[model samples]
Target: MRATSQDTAGGVRRTRNAAQTREALLQVASRRFARDGYASTTVREIADEAGVNVALISRYFASKEGLFEACLAAAVTDLRRDAGDTSLEAIAPSIARRMVGATSDGGRLPDTLLLLLRSSGDEHVDNVRREFLQSLSERMAAASPAGPETLLRAQILLATTLGMALLRTSMSIQPLAAATEQDLLGPVSDLVDALLAEKR
Candidate 1:
């Protein structure tokens, strides 16, 4: 009538395996979506790459759209974790340091940035991406010294980082792509001071 210790251990193992499967799907789906674009990637490809049942995608994410959204959320969460509780004054410099340090053996964009940059073609998914960027801008504005242009400044700061990531990683533009942290930190810090620092 009651479950034994062995049964309980089996349940725990099953739960752990489910979590692993879900993560595997997400990881493969993120890369596929980034490399192939959303419309071109298929549930079967993701499952095959992750070594999971195709039905698991529907079970875990409901649909490909849901999986894409989850991947975007994970990417944003990773960027936030890397940024930590950085102050407005430190935002640009912090981002620049990370950007310059980022490396990809194939010269591809980092999965996080690529996920955000790649288009999904679905209106709803595209809107979700824009909304994430807008919310990020709002958070940056809230952290900056209050002014009429605070939001505008925050958006510009966001644009600056996004552009740098695209050029340095995706485009592999010269000098910028090869730049070191020291090469970027001073300029980025100056930009932050001009954009967000309280006038004195």
Candidate 2:
């Protein structure tokens, strides 16, 4: 038989419904994983927040580990271009300021990474950390030399960004929280310039 108009409309509706469901689940999962941390945030909670069944999450993402991996992938993809475009010196301070700013109201991406770091516990955050850092290093080392100092600068920059993110987002420290945009950029940029010099 031939395809009918109703059949085509029904297919379109199903596709839209699935997309909406996935998007809703991802939004809930991302926020909860960011706010509550990944290990503490359960599929049931995410499901409830999304107003869907627990099985729906599994159907969309397979497992909690899979979901975390997806978030990591997203974080990596989003930052890859930013990391690739600028010098380490510029990138470092930019990262510090952006991270601080991103966390002013509690950022989901940074929080998710922090949560993953914490949840790793005694198992070693090395592999995951390395994956994130390696991509960063490669991106920043584009026009520069690659060596211990360069790696160190990259690592420190990453650490600074993450540390600032934690301080602003997680701990909610006053001086940092109250810091002016320039207050953050001034010191961070100087440090990055120095670090980049060392890498040279």
Candidate 3:
């Protein structure tokens, strides 16, 4: 028998619902993992928070480890999307703007940065975090003049970025936490120029 239009519509709706459910799981899982760390968060808690079936975690992500990995992957993708083709000269200001913008949004670290900063206490998970930072360092270095120290400079830049995010959002340090984008742009841009500038 041929499928009817109503059946086809129902199938489309089911697919949409499934996609939404998967996204919901990811968002909730990301927050839980960021706030509580992977080992400390439970699949049941994520499901209850997301209003989904507990079994759906397995259906979507296979296991808690799978869910954690998925969350990391999503966060990395988001950061990449935001960083698209930003020139070396523009990187520091771009990052500074994003860091300050994050402060406006409830004064919390972005889920992406939080995932990297938080320790899961699992060797495998921690290794993944290191690999991400290393990869990002390499990318930043590639945008600068090649030299023995270029990669090291990029790593420093990454460290500064991460440290600022932590202090401003997580630690809420006095003046830094209260700083505006304009307050940060000049200092951050100067640092980028000093670190990535070509030798005279």
Provide the TM-score for each candidate, comma-separated: 0.71, 0.71, 0.76
TM-score, cand. 3: 0.76
Instruction: Please report, as a residue range, the 10-residue window in candidate 3 with the lowest summed lDDT.
Output: 1-10
lDDT by residue for model 3 (40-138), tens = 889999999987678789978999888888887777766766666657877877777777664222323455677787665667867878888898888
CA error at residue 112 for candidate 2, angstroms: 5.3
- Give per-residue lDDT, candidate 1, residue 92: 69
The TM-score ranking, best first, is 3, 1, 2
C-alpha lDDT (0 to 100) for residue 66 of candidate 1: 88
Q: Per-residue alpha-carbon lDDT of model 2 for 64-104, expressed as tens digits?
A: 76665555555555555445357655664656555544432
Once fitted onto the true fold, the runs of candidate 1 whose alpha carbons sit more than 4 angstroms away are 1-16, 53-55, 100-110, 121-124
The positional error of residue 84 in candidate 2, measured at the CA in angstroms, is: 4.9
What's the CA error at residue 108 for candidate 2, in Å? 4.9
Q: Which stretches of candidate 3 lie over 4 Å from their true place?
A: 1-16, 102-109, 119-128
lDDT of 1 by residue, 48-98 (tens): 898766877998899988899888778767665666656786676667767
Pitting candidate 1 against candidate 2, the one with the higher TM-score is 1
